[model samples]
Every structure is written in structure tokens, then in C-alpha cells.
Target: MNTVDALVQLSFQVQRILAEAGAEHDLSIVQLRLLGILRDRQPGMLELGQHLGLDKSSITGLVSRAEKRGLVERSPSPHDGRGVLVALTPAGRRLVEVGEAQINRRITELTKRLNATQRKQFTQLASVLVNT
Candidate 1:
């Protein structure tokens, strides 16, 4: 395959691994992403939507579902009373931790055929691609 096709296939494989990891916690990939983003900082709905590349309505629905699962909470944004902030609950934090571990394990397995030098080269190449 060409470089673009190879990259696309790799992306899909990575996404599938993440989806499986999320499923173990009864979370959709989007919900897992929400928890991942909220793990670090409590961002308002608008900011969350922007970071997730979701529209406001989509963000609302995603957050609502996560809220129902007790993985996240919505509260009045401290910076803007009219807006709402999305934060990971303790349960969400724990789930994300486990999900991340699973993902890491799965990805590592995918690279098991590579030697240490190839793995380091791959990591550096991926970092450059991501940063650029």
C-alpha cells in the first residue's frame, strides 16, 4: 500500500483497539475520549466540544450519557455561570486508568514483532508526525 493507505489502515487498527478497551468498561469510544480529556482539567462544555471536535448538541448528548453512567458530572462553569463544566467523576478516572492500561497493552502486543531499535524508531517517527 502507499504511505497514505498504510497510515489510514494503522489508524483504523489503533481505533479498533481503543474501541475494544472502551467496551470493557461499557463506554463508547467517544465517551472514553471524554473521560480522557477530562482527566486532566475541568473544561466547560464549549471548550470540551471544541477539543473533541464535536458540536454543542453532540457534546450535550455525549455528556448526558456519560452522566447517566455516573462517569462524569456537569456543573455550572466557574468562569461562566451560564455555561456548564464537564468533569470526570472518580469512577470515570478509574475507568480511564484501566482503559489506558488495556490500550497500552494491546498496542504493545501489536509491536511485539519489532525489535527494540525498530520500536524506538517507530516511536520517534510517530512523535514527529503527531507534533508536526
Candidate 2:
């Protein structure tokens, strides 16, 4: 496959592996990503959209859907009242923590599948990619 197609395939595999498994809770990958981003900062919608590579309207819609689930909230930014800040509610934090652990576990499991030489290559590549 071409590089773009390979990247797309990798993304699909990652989303499928980490996505919520039960009918009781359904969150899209974008929603999950937004939660992760919020875990770091209470970003304004504009900043959040930039982080998520989405438009403001799209981020707003995603936030609206997540808010309905009691997972996230919007408050006035401490630095700017006119600017709304998006943050994870306690439930959202729990969800993100769970997702993080799950992702880490899966990655570890996958990494262990590699032999020693391949494992070194993987780690080296990951460090460079992530640092970049």
C-alpha cells in the first residue's frame, strides 16, 4: 500500500482496538481524541479544533454530543471570560484514563510480539516519530 493508505489502515486498527466495546457506551474516535486533548488542557474551542485537526463547528458539535453524555463541559476560560474552555468532567477523565491504559496495554502487547531486533527498530522509530 501507499504510505497514505498504510497510515489510514494503521489508524483504523488503532481505533478498532481501543474503541468502547459495550453497547452501553459508544464514543467515536474523534470524541476519544477530544477527551485526550482535554485531559492536557482546558482549551478554547478554536484551540481544540486545531489540536484535533477539525473545524470549529465540528468540534462544537462533538463537544455538544459529549456533553449530553455527561462526559465533558464548557466553562469560561480563566484567562478570558469571552472564551469558552472545554474540559473533561470526572466521568470524562475516568473514560480517558481507561482509554489511555487500554491503549498502552495493547501497544505493549503488540510490541512484545516483535523479536529483539525488530523491537529495537520499533522503539527507535517510535521515539523519533513521537519526538518530531
Candidate 3:
């Protein structure tokens, strides 16, 4: 297969894994992404929306739903009183940990045919592609 086809097929496989993991956790892919994004740092709604490629209203609704589910919290931004920052609650963090484990397990299984060297090479190449 050509590179484009190979990448597309691989993306589909990854998306399937993500869908399965999200379903297991009762999360949509976007919600899973939100949790993943929150695992490290707190960001204001605008930044989150930009990262997620969501518009303001859509992002607001997404955050509201997550907030209602006790998975995330919103607080006044330290830099701007009018701005709100979103963060993962303890429960959200736990969910992310579990979801990540599930994804890792499944992806590792899928890539089991590759030897250690191939896996390392793939990782390096993918990282370069992603970072660019």
C-alpha cells in the first residue's frame, strides 16, 4: 500500500480502538480527547476549543456535559477573572488512566507482529510526522 493508504488504514484501526475504549468508559471520542488533553495541564475554554477544533458553543456544551458528569471542573482562570479554565477531577484522571491502559493494550496487540526494532522505528517515524 502507498503511504497515504497505509496511514489512513492505521488511523482507522486507532479510531476503532479509541471507540472501543470510549464505549467501555461511557465516553464519546471527543470526550475521551478532552480528558486526555486535561491529563497534564489546565487550559482555558478558548485554548481547549482551539486544540479540539471546536467552536465556542460546541465546546461549552461539551464542557458542561463533562462537568455535569463529575469528570471535569471549571474554575476562574488565574490570569483572567472572566475566563474559565477546565481541569480533570480525580475521577476524570482515573478514567484517563484506565482508558489509556486499554488503548495501549489493544494497540500493542495489534502491532504484535512487529519486532522490537520495527516498533522503535515506527515510533520514531510517527513521532516525527506528528511533531511536524
**CA lDDT of every candidate:** 0.90, 0.81, 0.96
**Candidate number achieving the greatest lDDT relative to the actual structure:** 3
Question: Worst lDDT window (10 residues) for model 1?
Answer: 77-86
Residue 116 CA displacement from its true place in model 1, Å? 2.4
- Give one digit per residue, the lDDT tens place, for model 2 in 1-132: 997897688778766666742212477677778888888888898898998899878988999999999999999888986899988999988888877877787767756778999989977976997798
As for lDDT, the candidate ahead, 2 or 3, is 3
| Clashes (candidate 1) | 0
Off by over 4 Å in 3: none
- Per-candidate TM-scores read 0.90, 0.78, 0.97
Query: Under the 3 Å rule for N, CA and C atoms, how many clashes does model 2 have?
Result: 0
TM-score attained by model 2: 0.78
lDDT of 3 by residue, 30-116 (tens): 999999999999999999999999999999999999999999999999899899999999988988999999999999999999999
| Clash pairs (backbone) in predicted model 2 | none
Ranking by TM-score: 3, 1, 2
- Arrange candidates by lDDT, highest first: which order? 3, 1, 2
Residue 100 CA displacement from its true place in model 1, Å? 0.9
Q: Tell me which of candidates 1 and 2 scores higher on TM-score.
A: 1
Clashing pairs in 3: none
Please report how far candidate 1 places residue 46 from its true position, in Å: 1.0
